[model samples]
Target: MRLSVVDTELCVGCQCCMFACARRSGLGGIASSAITVRSMGGMEKGFKVIVCRACDDPPCARACPTGALTPKPGGGVRLNASKCIGCGRCAQACVLGAVQWDDDVNKPSICIQCGYCVSFCPHGVLAMEDK
Candidate 1:
């Protein structure tokens, strides 16, 4: 089970992981990435990194009228471009705020837990752990 885990105490707010995620989409920009790193509030609070939890029962899928969001082989939902209507329902259904979006394309960008971002975390904040 290769899952993305966060060691928040080790996080240095470098955002290297986030950049790697964007690059995984071959878009060379954060807009295409599924992960998000933002200040929890301010510098004193460090940052809050958001990624899909790979829920056993994903709410985003239940909210999709077109069934565009469906469960992956392991966890999380895979985006079926052909079935998607760009309604933004998946983004709104996520309780963790992990169901990110591509503003230009109007689609949900949930993490596949691929671990690409883990490699870029110089501070050992992100890891691909076998659970």
Candidate 2:
């Protein structure tokens, strides 16, 4: 399954999805979340929900020098933390900027397409769908 943005217009910038994503990793803050919510400028301009698009051939995976990231079956990538060198290349390679950084561990916190954040979207702005 892949997480999708169902409707950006519905987003209120509450960042509940971000919080839920972080919670799934047993973290207490948005710093670890794979998903992000940002204002366009102000509340009236709506919000942008940033998350992995599950690219078929992800550039981030291609940029992993240590073979730490491998492509998932459907889309996106699976990160092997043990092999990661924390080079930050994956984050830079991702055009969507979906590869989030974890300053504490110095590793990328990528979405596993687990859909944990979907349920927390009060505005129905997110969804999980089969590939």
Per-model lDDT = 0.80, 0.91
Residues 12-130, candidate 1, lDDT per residue (tens digit)?
78878877988886767688778887887886887787778787778998899998888876667888888988898888889778888888788877788888888788887777766
* Model 2, span 1-131: residue lDDT tens: 88999899998888998899889868688778888888888879998788998999999999999999999887899999999999999999998889999888999998999898999999899999877
Which residue pairs in candidate 1 have backbone atoms (N, alpha carbon, C) closer than 3 angstroms, thus clashing? none
Off by over 4 Å in 2: none
lDDT score of residue 122 within candidate 2: 93
What TM-score number comes out for model 2?
0.94
**How many clashing residue pairs appear in each of the predictions shown?**
0, 0
Worst 10 residues of 1 by lDDT: 1-10
